[model samples]
Target: MSNDAPVSTTHAPQAGTHEVILEMRGITKEFPGVKALSDVDMTVRRGEIHAICGENGAGKSTLMKVLSGVHPTGSYSGEILWNGESAHFSTIRDSEHAGIVIIHQELALIPEMSIAENIFLGNEQTHRGAIDWVLTQRKAAELLERVGLSEDPMTKVKDIGVGKQQLVEIAKALSKDVKLLILDEPTAALNESDSQHLLQIMDGLRRRGVTCIMISHKLNEIEQISDAITIIRDGRSIETLRVREDGVDENRIIRGMVGRDLESRFPDHTPEIGEVFFEVRNWRVQHPVRADRLVVKNSSFFVRRGEIVGFAGLMGAGRTELMRSIFGRSYGNVLGGQIIKDGKELHLKHVRDAIDAGLAYVTEDRKSLGLNLLDDIKRTTVSAKLSRITDGLVVNEAEEFRYAEMYRKDLRTKTPTVEEGVAKLSGGNQQKVVLAKWLFTEPDLLILDEPTRGIDVGAKFEIYGIIQRLASQGKGVIVVSSELPELLGLSDRIYTIFEGTITGCLDKDEADQESLMRLMTNTTTRPETPAAS
Candidate 1:
């Protein structure tokens, strides 16, 4: 937040010191009516971790696909030079043959397979046309050690945490003798500790003379680990900066990615928080499967008529389970609890009862629980309010289309038509559709779970604006997000949850990343600050 301007480091890197490992020039890709990338250019040093920076739908993934041959040689117009030789990769296998490996944002490991099995799934060790299990386990152990992991090769992939699985992926790449590694948002789903460990592994790879290319939205990590940074905007290369000498400024990088200076990432909204209109008191619930375990124990929280409340917790802290249980007992059996809305106590037996009781829940997994991807936009938008758009004995199609059109334009969803399938829309637009679906229900309270997860910065700001607008209209909003900065930026008041219980609650003026994380991990106990005025 300093007033100083970002330093300029747009010139190319010094050539005499570090050699160029890969280069792409005049890369252009088009899909249907969209021009994804237009004559983009990129360069990477031999042993440096180069970071690709851009907002969502900025062609970052597309450009990487072109380099890795996912788009194939003839599919796109680009010339790639690998170690001073032309690279005409026709398939992913071709790039792998050249020692190039790409780990996508979504992990590709099978859950049922063991660590060693996933590492050498397709490229396995063999002797005389037979699979060699012993050698495979030994080699997997070696790869795991190289990545600073001590996991058992026999352990199933599903048994490990997401952070450990990421290391397993790196071990898989090492098995291929990878020279150049491309990781696309590798730490997006990982927690703070896991992210730090992943970065350390990347540093280890760099020491071994491996060239690394990382695509990430976390500016702090990019600033910390990247030796060179390339900024892409609107399907074009803006500039590249040497993080050490160049301004290495966060504001400068953000401006380049957004095409303009954003004075504040979160929109300025002073909420007029009214009286406590919705309250959950003494709520206790048992684990969905393990009846002996209590997931939510003696948890009590309240939301005002016009307020944005945030729940801060680490992974598996029972934040999502608590909210899901309240929204129609979705996750666990409610042993004893009271949901009082406007002084009326009610019991919600099913999701329909929750929706009918003026409550709407937008799940974290938009693709799975929020919307039916194969269904068109119109059907998804009016799904929660079918009774409002239905006739005596049938669904009124025209009424549904009209409602969908109103929300499509209101939320600014980027779709050719309301008839378009939800699957075809980008992550951001699909999220907007999910929001629109709930908005039509006109609920008194909205529980948004990880609303901005896996989305771009621009889209995140838009969603923030929607949340602000919703609160401004006297609707109680509760948000659950993994990103602490997001909770700090958007929440008027934050409730820190730990082990399925409310550990501490802090007002906006007193909340910080350190304090929130401390409460989330149960490091500090006493947080009794009054709510902000």
Candidate 2:
């Protein structure tokens, strides 16, 4: 089977006759003007992997938060029955004490801490008044082995990759003797190989009689691994289906989540190609911290007006570094390169220069590098081009609101008002706001890095439509995505990168998963393209 294929759980027992380990009755959680979750019900059988499926703003995360005591007992109206006993958790500690541990989407491990320290961070193995270092390392090693992680317990967390960090989190849960494990979008950011390994680990946990509640947008993975899936929509409990008995598939899950059948995963788009308007020649970038390490080698690519160009590469293959370096040198140091747009050479030394030169880049890490969580939607939307709304050092709030509201309506962002904080918005809505921020810049060339990383299927279709609309308007778009199917479905032309080099360029007609993988891994010889000259 392919690495991206979902792992099979044929060895696991069916959940048909399993005992009920947890039950949440009428979980109604509200935040200010939004009823995040309303009358949401969920039941998890002992030793079963139960999945929660929903759209971005459908309150999947909110329901998990309530269950894990992040919202506390009094913050919401709910009855949680654990092993047939009523339970009230006023804090995260209370939940953990009850063996209900939740690993959030954003990992909580400190980068500077060692693996052992991170495992027993809060629940340290103490010797009288001090921490027992020997005992901590010894127990952490045992837990790591249980999760199939070969890393030493004393190794620093910063030295490991995201895949390894995730294993550490599971080891930490095992340290707590957790009975119920809740994972929220755990594999959302993981690559195909890492995701498969994590799924296997979950299956392993299930075998040891560990009950898991997973919230995910990946329907294929959910269908393969989960014994039962509960669908939530519009802040309400829709229905729960037994995976095998009900014959639930991705289509059925999509119907439950979106309230409609999406006839297609991508919006139909026909490219109106023109002469190449943007070109990069001999572009080379060095690592930001390591001057001797070249992250992006001598690479070149081009984009034509009214065209959507896709970039395909393995993780750490310099796809992002190449785009970022071109977009105002936001990432690595430029060793050498020349950017040509419309037959004119341009020099961009900073982010402002890139924006002013009609270039916009939407970063992959939206929460950290793109949007300011503390700011309101109106401010975030107009932030990239505040000069347009500013007059003589004074800002025009009306203009800000007008632009924000316009994009919000155009993008179909789900929000009560543009005045709401971006932190309150869902992943898809947050991504739309990021796109709006760049669109406000009125850039000629837009570089999107992983535009739909953690968004749901319905939202992905909408985002694809937005990209096509931009291309239809005679704009040049460069899309960098890890999902090859996305590139295949949306792009007119595709470029493959391997180890910081542009390995090959293939037109839409010649590109496929197999051919792209060949070029991406540098398995075949380089192809001559206009950029290669």
Candidate 3:
């Protein structure tokens, strides 16, 4: 089928009356024990940047899946109207043929392939059944430029970063002559500048008559760019707001999604800072892939026994690399560093050494690094300290289950049972499981990397409480977060990193969002007076 050709069964929303480009009426989707979407109704106008927002499991992604044909037409009860007519798409290709393209949160580009090859993968230009390499590269360059990407088209996808990869995905959609674009969390992993660039690109596309639907948790971005905002909660549409209308408040949008006014996004806490317990000195790390390049440069910091230390920086600022390298050299090549626990120097040559040294690093990407998805909660809980449940090489299942159940209640993890697979739990619950795993290890120093990322407001509050509780128990906690408000709200001490160097340090009393942002952006000048003085 021609990529640009409209599907025979696809109907476009009527052209006149502002052109309803897409309509989903009476959409109902059900899974075992879960009604994901219930008689959902949605309408999209032509060339508008429509934002679909909700808490996790709020049917935002499910509705997009239904539209993109990830859930085939027969699987859900719905009528899809496009360009003023009815449409039934049995497959993604069928929808794409009708100029509908979706870019999922998890990208689908082949890492080994070049950007040009990935963009024109399925619909490559061919002459006499042979791929037209020259034409393909030229067209790919044009598409890349359209998406504000200046990378060489021939560069392998693996060599580029996530922001560029997202742009490449957009370029691939443009190559398919996409008229309706659905982006699921396009800027979730992107830094502020990259996210802003992506939003600008979306605006550019809208001006070019491409209708866009974006799913995002970032309310600020939505408020800034969306022409319309639709809030869905519990598989139902709560309300839709026109940004151009008078008195459109962010609180109203949040209340619609959450069913309550979130007076504060962060929970209140009083940090009880104790004596210094964990300290890193003269820390340095080389890039894992490029051994010659230094990623973390002489980073030195300390967390007190009953304090939460916040690490703030832009993406690739070496925050995560510093934590990981100090944890056990789990990330980059350790060039030089000294970690001291209670005035005793410890060797962290390996992960086991770090663990034995009472150090635990909870990864930012928990799905791939922190938890074993296929394993049960009990198994995951004891994975970090199998020896605790082991009796002469034999694992004590009862002991493991008992510890898991205790932690489940302690952490307030919302799981049906400890026997349930960690994969079946919500993002917040999965994070709890990861925390439980490390807590079981009885670590003195805890490194939490984006511990509350992708969780709901309620879950975030609970997590904040947990962090405070950990500090209260004399555990030194270090948190790395992209959200500056989170760092300012939860931290006793804040350290700002910029381009692999620690640029500024501030106590909770002095670290406001604006000041932190200044330090994080590396715009603040160093004071002549000593910080201690």
The per-prediction tally of clashing pairs is: 0, 0, 9
Reference-based lDDT, residue 303, model 2 = 90
- Tell how far residue 223 is off in model 2, in angstroms: 1.7
TM-score winner between candidates 2 and 3 = 2
Ranking the candidates on lDDT from highest down gives 2, 1, 3
lDDT at residue 268 of model 2 (Cα atoms): 79
**Can you give the lDDT of residue 525 in candidate 1?**
50
**Candidate rank order under TM-score:** 2, 3, 1
Instruction: Please report, in order, the local distance difference test score of every candidate based on alpha carbons.
Output: 0.83, 0.86, 0.81
The candidate, 1 or 2, that scores higher on TM-score is: 2
Model 1: how far is 102 from its true place, Å?
2.5
Which portions of model 3 show Cα errors greater than 4 Å? Answer: 1-17, 112-117, 123-168, 376-378, 396-436, 523-533
Clash pairs of candidate 3? 11-82, 12-82, 12-83, 12-84, 12-85, 13-82, 13-83, 13-84, 14-84
The Cα error of candidate 1 at residue 495, in Å, is: 1.2
Assess the local accuracy of residue 210 in candidate 2 as a C-alpha lDDT between 0 and 100. Answer: 86
Worst 10 residues of 1 by lDDT: 1-10
Among these predicted structures, which one has the highest TM-score?
2
Off by over 4 Å in 2: 1-6, 9-11, 14-17, 109-120, 124-175, 523-525
